[model samples]
Target chain A: MFVRLSAALLAMAVLATAGSANAQSLTGSGKLLLTGGVSQIEGAAGGGLTPWAVIGGYGSARQIGANVYATDVNTTDFDIRSTGVLIGLYDRVELSYSRQAFNTQDVGTALGLGQNYTINQDTLGIKVKVLGDAVLDQDRWWPQVSVGAQFKKNDKAALVTALGARRGKDTDYYISATKLYLARGILLNGTLRSTRANQYGILGFGGMDDKRHTQFEGSAAWLINRKLAIGAEVRTKPDNLAIAKEGAAFDVFAAYAASKNISLTIAYADLGHVVTRRQTGLYASLQVGF
Target chain B: MTFIALALLLAAAPVPGQPGAATTPVIATDGKLFAEFGGREGLVKIVDDMFVNVDADPRINTFFEPAKREQTKARLVEQFCVVLGGGCTYTGKDMKAAHKNLGIQKADFNALVENLQKAMDKNGVPFSAQNKLLAALAPQHRDVVEKPAY
Candidate 1:
């Protein structure tokens, strides 16, 4: 299914460019460097841990843009790998798809599941820009705002339910606001999300109860120059599962745009407790945009 | 962490159009920003280089021709000089009046900004100083851009 979807998207991209007068100029007058934020873990354009209001890719208001990214997060007891693709339309709307694989290395053996047990989940996301502009409207006090949703489904439905998860599928809805203070070279974003997803939906959704909770995610970045930005993010998660205690996630990251098309992000991430206690390690991602 | 705290502090810091920075477009009362921009002579060179880039840029070149380029450059320099508190008066028309029939879109506006950034880079202007100028000029889009009628 993933292969078919990827092939269809690739065909669409090729056809769109072929139909344009100049294929190379399809993304004409690209956005300012680093304005289109990097891909988030759930595939939205944002910081490492949370989504921002900015769209993904370098396409300006007049063009269609797309990007493909792969992220790897390695912790003390687990390893997570995510890969995704996204498309942005006229700087107004965004659609994304990501596949996450969570490997429970030694923790799986401890829990009697097995060593190196893996849980796979697929996330489909859509975001719309509702108001304001983060970059151009520097004079305004209000930040750019966007509303988005991520629909996630885990492949191991039976396993997740046996582990106290109520469901193997759910949706996370969020609203994000971002502002870039050009003069001070600072970018700030805040997001409010309503969800029942446990461990970002990999371990399934709603273990304790069926009620959704509103959580907060925030990011603060300092733009060192056109190519580099360093930031930190804090994301509050719902402790829905009864088996293991969950806590807030934190990361300090640096993103570097090698050129108009490629960006690299690296971070030290503390995921609190994925399933085991004190899961923290290195997170790195690479993205290519057009 | 300390960085997040500092960022939050700066986020609440006084920006332009506030009491700390003055309400009007004349933001740099200390002449510090103007010096970083190389003053009037520096503005002239920057504007000239910007025009050269605009002329070469196919996306926005249709709005500017060689015949009116010189006059436009002079007006831009004077306007920028005034904005930077270089002690000059803008003799040119207002933003809306000047761009009345140009049919400028957001893309065009951004393209112009990109060209200006390149020109500033060529002049060795510091990034921070360049952003200060951009912040002051960013509000002009409200008057300059005219949405196309569908």
Candidate 2:
């Protein structure tokens, strides 16, 4: 599945660039550097793990921009690899898709499962900016707000059901507000999500029960310079999994926009209570955009 | 534990070889301080550079073309002088009155601001100094923007 998706994304990127004569000329001339956040875990334009209010890519108003990213997170007992593509339209709408493969390394054998068992999930997301511009409204009290939805489907449906999961597919809806304090060189984002997914659908959708709860995710970043940005994110989770206690997640990341076309991000993630115990790991991602 | 410590240390670490003592550039938030930096000459340079940028920016260039360039620049200088407490009273129209019918959108205002930033940069105004002036000018968005915030 990863191979197939990667092929499709690559093909689209080639096509978008090869036939780039018409709409490829982005003329809006957007704001300062690092204002457009990095891609999120689920392929949304945002922090590493959570979504922010800004759209993806460098395309300014009335322009189209595309981004491609591949991310890997290696933990004590697990390895998660995700790849995705995002498109930003007119700096108002965003569409993204990502495939995640959760490789339970030795932990699978320890849990009586086969060694290196993998759980895969596919996510499709769309977000629309409803109001405010984080960069333009720096002096005001208003913050940019956006609404988005993510549709996810897990591949290990039978195993997910056997583990007391609710279903194989579900959708999570969220509203986010992001603010960029240009003068202070700080960016803040807050989001409220209504979801039923367990372990972001890698462990399958929902938990033992049928109820969904609202979760909070927030991120803060400081633009140290035109090329460097450092941020921390915390995303709370719902405790629906009867199998294990699901705790909130935290990550501290540094992103370097090496150029307008490429950016690299490195982070230390503390994802609490996955499978059984805590998993702390290093995360690295590379994103290419036009 | 180690991650938190490392992040804190990175956050606290001084930015490598940049202007000002802090990671970001220094700015004079007050008129007296701004005067000490360069006063009228600095403001004039900033204004001149900003107009050059505005002239080049297609996003907001049309809005500026119909008006007399010199008169507008003079008014801006006067306004900036007063803003920085140069003791020059601005005799031009107030912000709301001056921009009432212009119907400036958030994007336009932001473009104008972007040009202003470039101008400040060209004149060697510290990032902090540019931000200070912008902070003082930010409130005028209420008068300049014809459209609602977005």
Candidate 3:
């Protein structure tokens, strides 16, 4: 149960970050509000946070922005680090890419996957706003929506497959909705995602199904002021490798919008053990755009 | 529910130190403007003249083409009222952000501003008051325009 909860939490954190990164801008709908900032969440949809229904960071048609970011995830057996770039176009559409490097530790020798094997994964993604500005139309019935996709390729797929994986490459699709109640300074966001990757390959893939997995994700943010935002998310994912149980995990985060071009995000994550204990860590991201 | 009631009360409360009460400025200013424009009956006449000027402007017509002109005119009245210190909230984008992405050229902006000036003149807004409002909006040009606006 702990492992399952931790996995769920990890997924939730990623999604939350993606949403913040993308929707940080006030342009809730249309192609005129993209920004160049990293989200507080990592590995979700936008540069840092989970996908938001809005098109870009808080900027509307009046500005342009972009971001470059890096992240490191430390585990007992291995450490994973990633670096990426995000670009916003006309405050309407976004393009992003990241490369992740996983370094195996003593656990690699014990498991025989390889002695200190290095695994690299590259991901590319795009997000487009579909409807409504949550900020401008706070009293309306419409919710802001966006559609996005990510393509990921694992560089050490041969080794991963040989270790018992069904597929080496995968793609994910997501539809996200974001709404901001400006009067109350509250923002709500949700995402429905479909993916084929197994457990983010923490325990390796191929134990169960290789088919696409359908997931539900949601988050809420309270804008305390123009600069500070506090939020949380709960995300559902598949426990394919028999490592963790299937369920939802929670993520709490804080973000600071330093300016139109820069922002910073930080979070504390708890990833429960698949077999025995829970794993918790600190996460941080910085995004800058022009 | 209580919040709604409070909002309504606040909206209706009289403004202080004018032809009416002395506690609320919104009501007083609204009354002043209403009287200056010849009261509720004259408001209709002024709206008609304003619409005539808006209809003659091609640059702003794109935003008006899809709508019922009468309805648009009503919203504009509310907007103008709110902007001119009538105490009504104007639920619209800040001028800079709204026009920034439209790639609105200087000619278009000048034409629209001129048309609005004409409407205000037609509505009999004092020249000083019109110039004050235009001055307040002038700084917005930096954000609303991305290219040389000439």
Candidate 4:
């Protein structure tokens, strides 16, 4: 029921803004192309791996915007799929919800579980702009900043706890700063995240170490044109699980805005060791919005 | 590793507002960018077309309604020319003075920028070149916009 309602709202936002002759209407799509970053893996508006400071959709100040996205990531031994909906209000506050499914594939059978065992998790997020303008304030050295939090819950509570996870539910907090060098066609973002999620909470939060750790994530992108951008992102992760050792994540991506209402992102992602072996694979995402 | 290299390369690019560089708003000094903008004649056409867009744009048309069209166009052309290193002089009032009491908001400023981008696109200006001009003008928001987005 909630999914249907969110879909209806997203469709309405697109239809209402699309037919308008003037983009400056009260609920108009006035922002420039590609300024609103694409949806991240966890459903925030940003790069494929990390969230940026920009709002989710094209709607500028005094307007409302929303989007729906589907993302898929396939590694040699696993498959991860995520889908979500997001809403940006007056470009000041953003709310989002996403669901992720992690397929363990043959690795599950090796661990005495059935093949293709899946762990499903849901995340709810909110972000508030703190200061500056990432797009319009191109002249200032200071970047736009935002604070956000994501509350997550995994369905496989018993299995994850058996695998040395402390809890199946937790919250991750982060602050992100994003800036665009308009003249040089460059965009840079830095985020500091406090989290205890092991394997992004798929293996559940905090294993032997039950304390949250601060981590850094960064992205640098070059705008090839108005509709196209190529970039790279690096995200540091915590090794809180005693069962597995983890490493930082890295990806190089290309995002293309086919039109005002749709965008596609493709990337080569290296997630380091998931559980047993080093995992690397292809990541793709599709976003549709106002 | 490749991501780090790419990021380093991008960060090493020339930054604006460096202390030693000449304080002028002009980005290019070699006249190459002026040629890319098709020189003074091209600027005239871009300014003219931008006004056409502005007039039809209800969001910001009211702001332009009080100004003299020809005078504003000429001043804009001169300002653009100076920014592009065309060696032109801008004789009009400073951005703060000209926009005083106009009640310009962030949305209105962005509207004008969109119109200008359309004009430049219509005039066949390269996207990167258009951004250079915009980057030079972007700082003027501090003076031109009276109402904050917050």
TM-score of each candidate? 0.90, 0.79, 0.57, 0.87
lDDT of 1 by residue, B1-150 (tens): 323433554476445234221122877878889999998999999999998899899988899867887799999999899989999988887787788887787778888998999999999899889988888887776667665342
Fnat for model 1 comes to 0.50
Report the Cα lDDT for residue B132, model 2: 61
Quote the positional error of residue B139 for candidate 4 in Å.
2.0
| Per-residue lDDT of candidate 3, residues A1-290 (tens digit) | 22443454345335534645564432222221122224423233332336675544433353233455666656444566666655454445766666667777565676675787677777777878655444433334456566777777888777666655666777777777676654355678777777655545433444477776767777777666446677776666666655435334555777776755566777654544432344445656665544
Q: Candidate 4 chain A: minimum summed lDDT over ten consecutive residues — where?
A: A19-28
Candidate 1: chain B TM-score equals 0.82
User: Which residue pairs does candidate 4 place in steric collision?
Assistant: none
| Cα lDDT tens digits for candidate 4, B1-150 | 323433453475445334321123878889989998889999999988988899899878889754588899999999999999999999998888789999886667788988898999998889899899898887686678765434
- lDDT score of residue A220 within candidate 4: 96
Q: In model 3, which regions exceed 4 Å deviation?
A: A1-37, A40-49, A57-59, A62-64, A75-78, A113-117, A201-207, A243-249, A274-277, B1-150
Report the C-alpha lDDT of model 3 over B1-150, residue by residue, as the tens digit.
223433443355343222311111122354664455444444456566756776776545565544567765565555555544655555655555555567754334444555665666777765545443443343344445445332
> What are the clash counts of all predictions, listed in order?
0, 2, 39, 0
Task: Give the TM-score, chain B only, in order for the candidates.
Answer: 0.82, 0.73, 0.55, 0.81
Candidate 3 residue B118 Cα shift, in angstroms, is: 32
Q: Of the pair 1 and 3, which is ahead by TM-score? A: 1
Q: How much DockQ does model 1 earn?
A: 0.32
